[model samples]
Target: MITSYNFYFCYIEIHEDYVKAVMKEGITVSPEHNDVLLQIVEKHYKNIPFVYITHRINSYAVDPTIYLETAKISNMVGFAVVSEDPKQKIQIKLEKTFFNKEFKQFDTLELALKWKDDMIKKYRD
Candidate 1:
């Protein structure tokens, strides 16, 4: 477990080549949210293409405008979002126009993790 600190809204796991973030419910995602994520990336992941996987397990509000700036983060190569909610899926579609989500929304975390592995494999090869 990541015992560094209690990141209330999100719990993150740093993989070999990707970061998986599981967001909590009833929260709002804003520009400030990126700061925490970036800190993790800077501390744990560097000198490599950055991949982000978001497991949306609960309802939350994400600022649509923030996606643009989020894309500009250094070395951001890909993104994966997992959610079964119809509303969230639609939002993901809208988000696709701004970001390159090679591994888009999946109904389950297992499927998303598989896709992340495939992405790493492809990147390695």
Candidate 2:
């Protein structure tokens, strides 16, 4: 089950032994606006080895630097995005450069889930 924090637009899923968080639309990747996001992630996911991020996060407006910084602090297995827009090709290229080995951008949520599952198997005993 996914529990949502409507105020911050984040969905949290608590498993038997792990937690997963999916950030919804309009998730600000700026330093100033990330306070709530940081808090929520820290509260529920700080110790989780695997975290998954789905949909609506491929916007060109997001600051890659800020996003990368947040991801680094969280120490997630990686994040997978779902975006098929042709306009986002360049943005994906640039984001890939920034995230490098820490993130994977995909065109579908299924692929993201698969990636997360694989990570869980590889990293989580």
lDDT of 1 by residue, 35-65 (tens): 8887877787676776788888878888766
Among these predicted structures, which one has the highest lDDT? 1
| Position 68, candidate 1: lDDT | 77
Q: Predicted candidate 1: what Cα RMSD to the true structure?
A: 2.2
lDDT of each: 0.77, 0.61
TM-score of 1: 0.83
User: In model 2, which runs have C-alpha deviations exceeding 4 angstroms?
Assistant: 8-28, 57-60
Specify the highest-TM-score model's number. Answer: 1
- For model 2, residues 1-125, the per-residue Cα lDDT tens digits are 43555445455555432334455565555676456656766776667675556465423356677665656654466666667776765676776766634576777767777777887777766
Residue 54 of model 2 has an lDDT of: 49
Count of residue pairs whose backbone atoms collide, per candidate: 0, 0
TM-score of each prediction: 0.83, 0.72
